[model samples]
Target: MRRTDPEGHGPVRFGPPLPADGLPVLPELSAVLAAAAPLGGSEPVGGGPALLEAACAYWARRGLSAGPERVVAAPGAPSLLLALTAALGGDVLVPRPCAAWWAPYARLLGRPVFHVGTPAECGGVPDPYALLETVRRVRDEGGDPRLLVLSVADDPTATVAPPEAVHEAVEAAVGEGLHVVSDETWRDTVHAPHDTVLIGPAEMLPERVTVVTDLAGALLPPGWPAAVARFPEGEIADDLHARVLDVLTALGARVAAPVAAAAGYALTEPEPVTTRVAATVRLHARVAAAAHAAVVPSGALARPPRAGRHLYVDLGPLRTALGAHGVGDAQDLEEFLTARLGLPAPGGHRFGDDLGALRVRLSTGSLLAGTDTELEECLSSPSPVELPYTQRALITVKSVFDDLRDDAQRWEPPR
Candidate 1:
């Protein structure tokens, strides 16, 4: 089949392909396709302000008093975040090992991103004490230090801040006059009771915080591209909304009629889809746990994933062993595994992590193996034995773990 690279080396397959149901063509969306379609020249050039109001009302019912004027809708959260970067008029502070998107967003906004230290428990929100120091240093360097972007229930790390940590972060942001943007995209995917705090930005810093959540993370497909942001009541709310509209209008980032309609339907539906999605989340949790367990003896430590789809493993403990085995860095290890181990993982470097840091984000979504029919069957089953692809994935991953474990050089005693 000539699948190998041009060099004729062994073939490497890093990860699984995106799923069908995970895309936007689900039954719920299909139902709303035409009804939610946006009329041409829809008076509001950017977004339907009325639709923004409805979303705000929806979020308010969920414990956030979102003013419609402060609410904005866009094609996705990343676009809105870039607008925030422009509006805040300063450098953005993001924790290391954040989503791969942040760097591009920051670059697009022409803002320098300060990679801050993450809390021990989470990946996006900075450590409180470290934040205090970093803010001062940033100010000293003449940066505006006006914005903080936190990906709560973070992506790559799969850790959510405990309520107490959230409280601390809010306090720090407020103290610094830093406008906070809490990216709660993965809020709905939380698995454990302690895995999430239902509080929104309005609950934390009613005046200073802006909440932007891309329903794409949960309800919609990745390419579906529709998101809502809540701006708290203030004079700047109207300005921010207008600015958001401006960006959308210029970028032509309006949510597609069919996708938005489908999203609205999913939001209100009292159907089995939510249950189906939750089951998928549970599957991810299981795969993450299994992967963590398998790699534990190999010095790959994962911070018990609480929410979201990926498990972040710190391979630092085995760095020396891998180094001896001629693995150059985390990227090198990712390359080696993709080639030798047939596991595709996004390198830690993609997430603004240290180049040499032995961290890798492994998404278990590959385990959702099967056709749409098979997936539906699996979703319906009490405990579906994973299909062939998933079995291959587990075996391949476990073999990597087994290899590392058997190699005496890889083990490191916990301090």
Candidate 2:
């Protein structure tokens, strides 16, 4: 289960990308890029006027009013976040099992990162009580806790935080004089938009929260490397936006010109982009549910998949069986499951969770997509979960967990 790339070829990536989603670029996106490629020129740092305006429209739809001057765009969310972290300095606080890539940016700035435990209901926002206590403890120990990063629609664990939970967490953070960064990357990918109550911190505390969305989570492919951030508008935002722009300028983190054009178009939410995103959400929703059904039936614990393309399964209930198979911790479980299931399953350790916990994030993207042709078929199929190729993939997942269930029954000692 060892994965290695040759040295001196390229730098290794450190982040939460659960392998690439192998789906082809939407034909509409490709057309936009092709047309925009010819008018290529460097995009201004932050973003061009058009891109920023489109970003405003996007945010406006989400019940957050933002002006073009208050938005920023970068090649990726990590870059925008890094710039944000640099611009607003101090120790960073993140949920215990935050996005795999979150805490690293704070460390890049020599800022201490403290992991706060999440509430039982969700994995994105920290438990409100724990957040208050952690902030107090950090300050008492001379750690300047100034930033809190959370997600309403989270990765690894695909559950969306309830609006009440988000409100309490935001209140706890801002009450302590800390700013919030709400990563809404997966907001548009909600499996059941009507059933979920997602409230970004920005909606509650406009002046203190910054919203970041990576288009890869829905509108664009990952390789395109486009994301946008919205800062709250006020007199203070002028300085904050300029500081972030300065950081982007120094880091050369501008979105490529063609990417800017495509992003601007995507942000406008045209029929094709909207339709593709809707279908993709539906596709992932079906596969994620099937994956969850597979794991939970084997006595594994998992939050229901409400958003995004993955499920976070805690196999602690099957630890005896897994340990019998020499899978004692998250790392070993990651390797074992990936090797056995033939998918890219990443351990919870990658997301700052305890290494001893037998937890992993299973991506539906690779599970349902064995070939490009099959991907297209599933994407268009009326009942994708029942489609031949998709059903085969689901069977493969179910078989692995069924084996684990059998092993658990045989391996665990009777009371």
- Distance from true location, Cα of 44 in model 1, Å: 4.0
Itemize residue pairs with steric clashes in candidate 2.
none
lDDT of 1 by residue, 70-155 (tens): 77777778788877777667777777767776656666666777777877766768888877888888788777778888867787
lDDT (0 to 1) per candidate: 0.68, 0.85
lDDT of 2 by residue, 299-361 (tens): 999999999989999999899889888988777888899899888788887887877888889
Worst 10 residues of 1 by lDDT: 1-10
Name the lDDT value of residue 195 in candidate 2.
79
TM-scores, each model vs. reference = 0.87, 0.94
Q: What is the Cα-based lDDT of residue 152 in candidate 2? A: 91
How many clashing residue pairs are found in candidate 1?
3
